[model samples]
Target: MTRQTGAGAPGSPRVAGAPARLAARFSARLEKWLEAERTQLPLWLPVGGVAGVAAWFWLPAPAAWQGFLLLAAALALPGLVFGRGGRIGRAVALFALAAAIGCGLIWWKAARADGAALPHAVVAAFTARIDRVEPLPARASVRLTLHPLMVAPDPRGGAIALPGRIRLTVPLEDAVAGLAPGATLAARARLVPPPSAAVPGAYDYAAVAWFAGIGATGKALAPVRLIAPAPAGGPSLWLADARIALTAHILSELPPGEGGVAAALATGDMGAVTQDDNNAFRNSGLAHLLSVSGLHLTAAVGATMVLALRLLALWPRLALRAPLLLIAAGCGGVVGIAYTLLTGAEVPTVRSLVAALVVLAGIALGREAMTLRLVATGALVCVLFWPESVAGPSFQLSFAAILSIVALHELPWTRRMFEKREEGHVRRLLREVAALLLTGLVVEAALAPIAIFHFHRAGLYGAAANIVAIPLTTFVIMPAEALALLFDSVGLGAAFWWVTGRALALLLAIAHHVGSLPGAVTFVPTMSRLAFASIMAGGLWLALWRTRARLFGLLPVAIGLVMTLAAHPADIFVTGDGRHLAVRAPDGQVALLRQRTGDYMRDTLSELSGREGDEAIALDDLPGARCGPDSCAATLVRGDRIWHLLATRSPYRIDRPAMEQACAAADIVASDRRLPGWCRPRWLKADAALLAGTGGLAISLVRPAVVTVAAMQGQHPWALHAAARPAGAIHGSYRRFSQADEARHHSRNRWRD
Candidate 1:
């Protein structure tokens, strides 16, 4: 194996061509394996991530440690690649070492941040420094991370009033830190959730806090109290200034009327973006822009690089590649620092800076870093910095999408597709447009299943909106934004800010219009983990697999088909008795008698055929044929038998003997009764299951099957099926829910409402 050495001597082996030699060392099989790894690596990451999610699903918290381990193995792929020892093996060896250290650090932070059992609220004389500011619409809130100097639980053991935060915004921070790099403040605020319960097995606030280095949360009890004005107010405050700046600048520039959305997209101040704006961004498939991701960083640096290269090329004396490379690296650092300051240095922003640094370093060294290595390095760094982020959506989805892009784009055909095109400014511009659109599409499509399973909604039209707006923003808006920053820094905001805002407004208008276009997005109410597996796997194969074989392309398609088939359709066919909702099963059987009806909320579900719609007649009515859990029930009308029931103001009259027989042989029981302190057989909650074990609404909803039920006597017979898992110490914690009373019951953190 030829080693890449730095020393130059005739006797010394040539080290300059190590990269080429390394590439050549591969056998056809090794080459294929590497290519496959590139393709499969991304696909596997999400698959592994989902698997971790599934393993801990239904449990109270995310298994951050286990999740980190799985991710570590994935990052150590190069070592997994080089099973044998040789000079080339060392490259993979170092990669694995980095991966290990990164994972180890994350594991430690996760444990420290895991204040899962800490009191939610506390009244104490605590001082929480504003770590960063999240941009929001009407007002802005500073993210106050506490040092946990004191912890006093409330006597009530219910609510804890810890501290408060000030409404620090972009302009506000500039006003506060006008002349200093690091400023200081003390505040008392209430830190709580954003008006909804976070999805289980997806994003855990507690886990998120660990990575963010937060122990407790609350909104500011009053305005912030100024503590000091040192450079860092101490080393602690100094550490936070860079992160806060990036988000602050973008917020400062946006028209105050737009709410937090303008700043959110411009920078990574998600706190500033309102929920509605978040929804809009999600629907528009432009949410990535708000995250301060590799895309944004790359765009910033690339623009600077191109300009630097162009300028440097014009200089006859400095035509050597090394100088251009050095200049690019320097420019990248400048832009990244400016960006971080502007966007408010967030975890994502810091990670992105690392990625930008890699790009810069590659240029400075005059060596093209393999895109995968850079991705791996960024990932390793993220792990080292915020290990708990392994369980965060930002970390999981961002890394997954980036790796997918690297993997898919690296496909020879995927690359050749562009290479084959003609060279020219117009051609290049068109290619850029295509690349941006494709990039958005790939990420959206890849993340769609997870988004649906965790939240809900597909944003069907987002791809088109992105395709239209992305090119305009990348070429027109970003450049203007950078130029505006320079002018503003040079005391030209009066001119630059106006020009920049106008250009930004134009881009925003394009996005809004494109997003407003018909069929821009569709909301899918529900989905399952299996569907996530299928979507990403399918997307990877479709983008990466090199085969003329038609069947290969169809593998992922087939997997999706199977998953969709298994998931009951979104439309709920509620039965009179809650235990038996008509769900279109995957086996093509219309078992119109099942109780799990919440599948209606799952946006990803699709009925196999006429199972739900065609047969639905009434609640208390039975059809021509008698069909029960074991046999058929009496008809609601004069007809033979129908799958329908009747709602009554109170308990309804029923043939005691017949009902008793049905109950005796009944495989499930359901009721809408709110009465607690009673136990019943396989209970149901208004046509939904109420059991401690299997076949609950969530499980049944994910895998809808036709279940035949017996009868319902009491009015609102569905109430009779309300089954509470044999009450015990853990009963309240694992209680199942139904849609009927969902609006009324508010679930708090860790347990049901």
Candidate 2:
């Protein structure tokens, strides 16, 4: 009664207890969420690993010791969390540890992959042993993966050290006889360092090459002389030789256009496929069929298992003595492994093979297969070994598509809706079609953002196209090709080959027709990393979570799409070498400063601006543009300002006086040659000196700023080439491990160890 005057007021009991009640409620909710996500824990293990790999790639020049320190800290997290925190803390700690391990592994791989960087390009004669051979019959060339043995002395009277591996595009006439792996050859070639990104924030081919252990690329200048024939040894060599033979056999047996598709499906070689065909497939959403991935692997394994089971059933005594299912599973797994190895063992194929083998093992062990868990396991394994692949489109697209499909099937309602029951044939067929349609739509939606992020476009009709394309490729083309290959040895495969060709022709026709439909492709301007990241996060959330709370993921996804739509693409674009320039006028039309530039450059510019190459009009055709033989002057209006641009067309000598006057009057200048200080523009002077430092240039008048490739690509080992530095500045411990240098200096090659 006395406390009621102060602490114990009339409603004090309810108010004071409110805090405790809220705390209890919050704790209960968190525990409920945890319980709900209990089965979802394993899925996040790979997510953490992928996040770690992504962090490594995105961070600028991460030190090895830093990763080790992070690993140590992450390892200690579990102990501290276990002692002081609850289940949620323990889960977070485990996830942190997985991320740290992923980061550490990728860091180690990157360090190991580091090799000598070529200071500058040089055309010289070199001797190298071929490590691999890729036939590009469509391009009238053969690509050789070479291990450099010797290079002729440079013009400055010094030996040139080549990297451990280099790719040379040898013309059909320049390629030597028996130009296969394990053969040594001498050739004149233009050896150059890996090319950098074309524009700011574009794809970094240099980084990809670096991770692949390819330090340089070149084109053969003259015919190569084979010093030695291919040795009849090495498993990789045998595979390469066999792949070449298989590709040739497929192409030889089938008709021309259809054979390229056939060979691609059979051997995972797309060199024979023409650019037009590739584009058609890509636009029609049938491009995945060309890539030997989970679909092909599953089909092959299933076919083999069915055939094995049928054959084993014929031998009733043997079938009784052994478990037929286990035996069939074993046979299927063996055939799958063989096929994977035969087809180059690419990342996607290997990932599929791993999952297939796991499923087969589950069958043999009489265990239920958890599809989503199996996908997670395969992804985690691939991330552990090929961490760099996490950054690639192939890895992202394949995993995203599969995860979405599996997650769709994992939903309770989805299972109920598709549950098998006694029904008429028409009902069953309709149910199957509906299931396929739903799956295709889910996969397409999941893959759209990724496709747009990489290709700057998404196929609108992909799902509809796949309804016809998939069954044609799977049930007809794959099985026919398999039978054709089997019967080829007995010289009775002609009929099967004809069937295969007809199926492929129909597939290609479907692709072309679908691709030609109006609005088949939706082009999007280049999106920012943040937008892409948000989309990725939301997609993972939606795919990983099984509860209704997963619907919350749509918030970030919608935000990302809005951001992408509201983005403002740069109005001015310049190549890294300053040899090309493009300007987008106020009317939303683009014009090229040079009419003579190649199609590749034009296409690149068009894609970046979210337009087709054919849609870009000539600079001279623009209303406010005037042109001459060696230069062009243009005016662009953005917002309230009028900007003037002067761009030189020729790389050779220009009229210096006229250029200087024009530069003084213009707001922006672009030239391939080094310009004098007096020729400076008011805003930008994109001459050789400036372009060398910037790498590439993208100017946005709306933002009134410029973005450079060098700035976007941070100072990584692969990007050091883009930095303006002396040629001799690149001589470091990394180059000391070069095979060519080690042979002469007789020093330790730590890379080998």
Candidate 3:
């Protein structure tokens, strides 16, 4: 056949027309979508706020110069766009502005966190004033925030000025003169740097500590002696004193555990509640009650409004002349502010207060309070002020639950159902029960993915638990607590507290009973980030859009669920400290190489593996494992391949005999000591230096003969401080091993006796 030429070529016309046609179609669609999206600009504002927070978190901590440049660019771009550009341009500018604000806030926060931390553990004498004191629940220890006046190397050494604050966990026995805010004390303390994350993408303790202005975490080495007592009757000490007094009064009125719960609900001090009680509430799906969040705040404010209105009714002159609803909303606002302050103004509490105030403002303006626009506005305010909270579980979960509930309630069908009137008491009661059930289901569904992502567990009976728990908390426990606070101002609190305690005891019993049910808790394996993102996107789409197009959001949800189901656990896990190693055996149970240390990391591994409890298993529990005084070894068999892991605690000098034995018996060796020269070229080894730099390690056995390794500290902000190996080191090592294995025809006898 003759070759094609010119315009008559076989595929020329088709190929040439395709680009033109595709460009025309794409341009048309883009224009149409932009026009529609422009009308929903208010809805997109919260999205822009979220984007800003995400941009801040995704980027590495910027240098001071880079931060300034970012701020300049951010400011200049918005100004230029707003001045010269059209609607689309203005929207773009707004998004950029919001993102810039987030970046700037994080940068400023990071700069403030540059205080000196003790690199190694050291016992030093320190004189400091307590800034705040929080008691640990059911523990004899109390956490104190201290501002250092002077830190001495020893009794003879010169004073050292320490910047930022220190968190001291002092045992009650060591608090000889009693501890309170503004009390100056001198004591010996063992101080160290804040801990880093134990596993990748887990809680960042160091980052939280940095943001909270805590430079170091330490324990008091001796009894703390009061150098100066707190001043008498000052506004600065009033809130703290009141909180302490309230907590003590409640405890005095009720039994230990029950009183602790009451105090936590009323004053936001959870120190008295035992760990068992906390776990019971958490597992029972009623944990929200313990935290003074939106639910509690709304309940308190509503009760205050009711009480205010009833009292207003006694003075019929004012009730007839004024708009009672507006007056009630104003009263609620004042009460909400007081409650917020009384609860220490935590991030969640503040966010809830903002939402409540927005509602009151809406009532005063003769507009609906539960609109999406108002919710978005509240969220925007929170993100602007406390951008760091965007990364926290409380912010994410609370917002998710509230947004979902509001969105569901605003649905046409739901609204219509509420609009229908029922006359009889039985009918009204039934309607109320149905509404509660639906609300519980919607909230649970919306927050389930976030719960699983952060905690790796979901409350299976949460909806049922909430059904029984919500009414009791809302009507009995919260109202009684508020009443107790009121009566306590007049020295009649003991009677009210006694009543509140009885109600709390009943609530706790319900939580315990519900939490004890079989399958109340369901463990979920770690979901991939991509899967989580998809689920969140789908949820947002469903919640924000008010059209049938929202049905398409289910597509991403399905895809995410499929991805989650196919995900598998890593084959091996090692701790950041190089103290413990866990390998998946043939039967899929994790085998431990060391028993005592890295309990936290071990528990994390267990949870990720879908194991029931976080308890550590003994080395001898594994098949073909041996432990010595200074070393331990284990063999994990998967299919036909046997993988060896060895851990030793000796110093960095090479032990020739041990090296030979390890190399002869294992495919990989993990040790504190450096490997001998001959062994380095033969086996895959992770030494103390590598572990210290990488933070932790996870390995996947792609096949019986091929293994892949990933580092936990891969390019994270915390990892940047450590001395890093070249980016390609892990892949290069794997490649070299793969090449060798292929050359030897996958022989098991590559290392001979």
Candidate 2's C-alpha lDDT?
0.82
Please report the candidate that would top TM-score against the real structure.
2
- Between the candidate structures 1 and 3, which one is better when assessed by lDDT? 3
- TM-score: model 3 vs. ground truth: 0.87
Candidate 3 least-lDDT 10 residues: 704-713
Instruction: Please say which candidate is ahead in lDDT: 2 or 3.
Output: 2
Question: How many clashes does each candidate structure show, in the order listed?
Answer: 95, 0, 1
Count residue pairs with overlapping backbones in model 2: 0
Please, what are the lDDT tens digits per residue for candidate 2 over residues 1-753?
A: 356635557658777888999998987787688788899888889998887887776665556447644764666576465635455665676677778878888878877885556778888888999988889987889999899998888888888888889989999987767998899999989988888888875677888888888988999988999999988988888889999999999989877789889989999999999888988999998889999998899899999999999999999899889899999999999999999998999877998898789888888888765478888988998898889889888899989988998899989999999989999999999999999999999999999999998888899999988998888888999999999999999999999998998999999999999988999988786788789988999999998998888998999999899999999988989988888887876666778878876877887887787787778888889877888777788767676556677888775666677666677667678888888878866567777877776677888877676777776666566775445642223121011112342232223211100
Q: Candidate 2 — which residues are off by over 4 angstroms?
A: 1-24, 61-85, 725-753
Candidate 3 deviation (Cα RMSD): 4.7
TM-score-better candidate, 1 vs 2: 2
Q: Considering TM-score, where higher is better, how would the candidates rank from best to worst? A: 2, 3, 1
CA RMSD for every model? Answer: 14.2, 9.7, 4.7
Q: How do all the candidates rank in terms of lDDT, highest first? A: 2, 3, 1
lDDT (0 to 1) per candidate: 0.48, 0.82, 0.72
- Each candidate structure's TM-score, on Cα atoms with residue i matched to residue i, is 0.61, 0.92, 0.87
